[model samples]
Target: MSDDPTGPPVSERTALRADCASCFGLCCVALTLTASADFAINKDAGTPCPNLAEDFRCGIHTRLRREGFSGCTVYDCFGAGQKVSQETYAGQDWRTSPDIARQMFRVFPVMRQLHELLWYLTEALTLPAAVSLHAELRASLDATERLTRLPAEDLAELDVSEHRDRVAALLLRAGELERAGVARRGKRSRRGADLIGARLTGADLRGAELRGAYLIAADLRGADLRRAELIGADFRDADLSDADLTGALFLTQAQLNAAKGNAATKLPDSLTRPSHWSADRLPTA
Candidate 1:
């Protein structure tokens, strides 16, 4: 799995999904969390979380949301965790190599961003509406994949924000082309709208541009979100139990993680339902 141009195939693209079993608990270790509405305690970067197990698994994985670490449920390393643990580090454990702990921690966040670009590029290529841009998309995808395979020294020096900016531009163009119905959102664009705790159940948000919108705790049960551009929208604690999100573009796992959803919710093929979320769980009235 060293530098390969072809990258992971479409089927294997899903395999790029985070395999926490093969990971070194990077999210729980490399990342930090302070006592806030999200985490219950303060954790400095590079320190292993108290809930981290000997096998690199979260000891309280299932109880994370209940234990006041609801933020943990929203974080996704986008398969970077496994790639770093198994490929980049070549099976070395931090316990044995305390010297490389800093490098490993730094590389994890960088790799996660790179992997997220891979996810977007992979998804962009899947959209048939952007058929004309496929060649350019493929080129960017291959280049991003190659970057992810770079050595730790190179990765630490990478201009991750620059790469993300370039990739974001491309994804934006693709989203525009795919969602020809973009004009349907409304005359008043809700871009970055602050609708926290608003009563929006069953609202017609089709094709709405809600990028960076703060939707924390918004009650959106059964909302029609078809063709909506949900890039960077916060769904934290918002009720999405019966929402239809088919064709919603640019939404991330992190955003979805912050939301509450159930079996009736419709999501894109690229995402899987949070394990902590269940069908029988009723929305708070």
Candidate 2:
């Protein structure tokens, strides 16, 4: 995960998959929806989408983009969607067993978070600049992988968010260690920014304000985002492949997501893709 949000081609980096067939449409059934550009109608957690076929496939999947459902296009499964459908419940249909359905719904979100962490950890391991943090990254990767393999019942019972927060602390430390000598001196304010690792990949940003920012390892694959405000910043190892940006606002995407934001999440151009886990409603940046 480079500092540039839009550093490399998404194809070059490992993209998580959505194995829907293996997961019995758990994501569709477990998650709720509100009417917006992404979904045609509103839905609750347990009910299946009207377009869901009996075979467990989306009826309008092929036409989602044209049928006013582009939101579905950006969604990623991080493998949890399929894992729960097949491995966790052993291909058990949530529709057939109300209890299992409830459990599956409960665990889907948790697993999604776990998968997101896995994505970041794996990406971190690929960075040469982060060589000093390799040992820490590997440890975090192992821990995150173990969490991914937890049994349904245990996963349902575990405090996955707390665990994610704990792991995130280590990752943040790694970033600090990697950029130790590069720290800027000054105070800035970047409240509620939505960076999510924008593909700055090599832009020139000197002395910007980035408080409560959302910069999740955006392709910054190697841009310079230094000497910025960075109060509650977020930076989840964006791409930063080889850009040049210096002295930007905020710090990381994780910091931004954990902080408060209104309808003003200033995002990087490259990370315009909507989150699959997020509802169609825009974030109150």
Candidate 3:
């Protein structure tokens, strides 16, 4: 993990490491890849990263920035990589046991995704503005943790996308509940918009125009938005953890922030704290 856990703690540096020194390069050997932004060569699932040296370190580690391997730089393991390498498989290298290595390799990605969700959900729960969604947050958190603890075979076969879709439904519902009873009036123009599942966390959107718009499950964490104009707009389960909006033009704090605000949540320049609010306001959702 990075020395500084502040800021958006979702970067690769914040992820856990597998301590490649003690184990074989199971991740590289078991996983396959095609030429993409993170890699330069086409490789199959069981192939190792070409940059992986025999010593289990990245061959291009010193020059990864210049070698078009920036993707590798951003990947975090959340400690699962090492867990798999040491605890689960007992430090067995892919070279020593290709079959087990393959299983580990396949499971690594699944665990990584779960960890990423945990990171986001945990961070989300820290926002005071999202108190209204506390039930939903806790539920999601439990679900995410369950997935993280799934058996390797089960995780490998899990349909993560389908799970994401299901969770999204709950988030959308939370958004609706939070924005209930707010009057929306304006020249509606955000019809048929595709803001669904967009990560607009902590965006500065004060006094813009968004009528009849679709913002379902948007990650509006820590956004600097205060009353611009929002009539007939959808904020289904959008995360607004630590957004600031003291004098937002038309938004109602009860309707907007009430849905999902945390203690770390920042408020607008002139708004007072909500009565049912918590002390841990998130920065912005």
lDDT of each: 0.82, 0.58, 0.56
> What's the CA RMSD for each of the models?
3.5, 9.7, 12.5
Model 3 regions lying over 4 Å from their true place: 1-27, 36-38, 77-79, 171-285
**Which candidate do you rate higher for lDDT, 1 or 3?**
1
State residue 253's C-alpha deviation in candidate 1, in Å. 2.9
Candidates 2 and 3, the one with greater lDDT: 2
Off by over 4 Å in 1: 1-11, 182-188, 281-285
* TM per prediction: 0.90, 0.62, 0.53
Scored against the true structure, residue 214 in model 2 reaches a CA lDDT of 76
Pitting candidate 1 against candidate 3, the one with the higher TM-score is 1
lDDT of 2 by residue, 49-89 (tens): 78888888888877886787655665556677876777778
Clash count list over all predictions: 0, 65, 54
Poorly placed runs, candidate 2 (over 4 Å)? 1-15, 96-98, 176-191, 194-285
On lDDT, the leading prediction is 1
Error of 3 at 208 (Å): 8.9
